[model samples]
Target: MDTVIVSSQYQIVIPQEIRESMGIVSGQKIQMIAYRNRIELIPLKPIAQMRGFLKGIETEVVREGDRV
Candidate 1:
């Protein structure tokens, strides 16, 4: 496990090994999600990454086979 030290200035440097493994690049957007007792940092996924991902997930079908 890797740990980061919080400096008195309230700044932290993420460990290089962790950063490389997670493929986190400079200036990439991240999402901060708060769990019950912990915070999770998730990489922000653009809508383009979701292509064909949710094709089968069913939502309400509106006006099914509309009658002319």
Candidate 2:
């Protein structure tokens, strides 16, 4: 696992390997969430870039007779 240290200004630098693998570029927006005991950083992508992200997701759902 990769580890990072928080700077005195309360900022942290993402390692080079992780940045490249995640396609994170300069000035890209990232959403930070504090969940349970750890923090999560999610890269935000533009709507145009999110096209067909769920191309193969299962769409079948079992429904009750009345609902169907």
Candidate 3:
């Protein structure tokens, strides 16, 4: 485990080991998710990384109306 110190402005540098292992380059976008007492960081890749993900797929969530 690595220990990181948060600066006065509340910013911490990610460890070199984790960054290199995860291939986290500069200008990479990250998504922050908060669940209960834990926080998750998900890396968001470029649009090119999402090619062929939605071929002939239904992009809708069918909902029933007039529920009791």
- Indicate which candidate wins on lDDT: 2
Measured by TM-score, the strongest candidate is 2
Q: Over the stretch 1-68, how does candidate 1's per-residue lDDT look in tens digits?
A: 77888899987776898778888888878888999998688877679876899897989766757653
Pairs in clash, predicted candidate 3: none
For residues 1-68, write the lDDT of model 2, one tens digit per residue.
Answer: 88899989999999999999999999999999999999999999999999999999999998998994
TM-score per candidate, in order? 0.57, 0.82, 0.65
Higher-TM-score candidate of 1 and 2:
2
Q: Evaluate all candidate structures by whole-model CA lDDT and list the values in order.
A: 0.80, 0.96, 0.86
Per-residue error for 62 in candidate 3, Å, reads: 20
Q: Which model, 2 or 3, shows the larger lDDT?
A: 2
Q: Local error of candidate 2 at 14, Å? A: 0.3
Cα RMSDs, all models: 4.9, 1.5, 5.2
Clashes of 3: 0
Off by over 4 Å in 2: none
What is the lDDT for 15 in model 2? Answer: 94
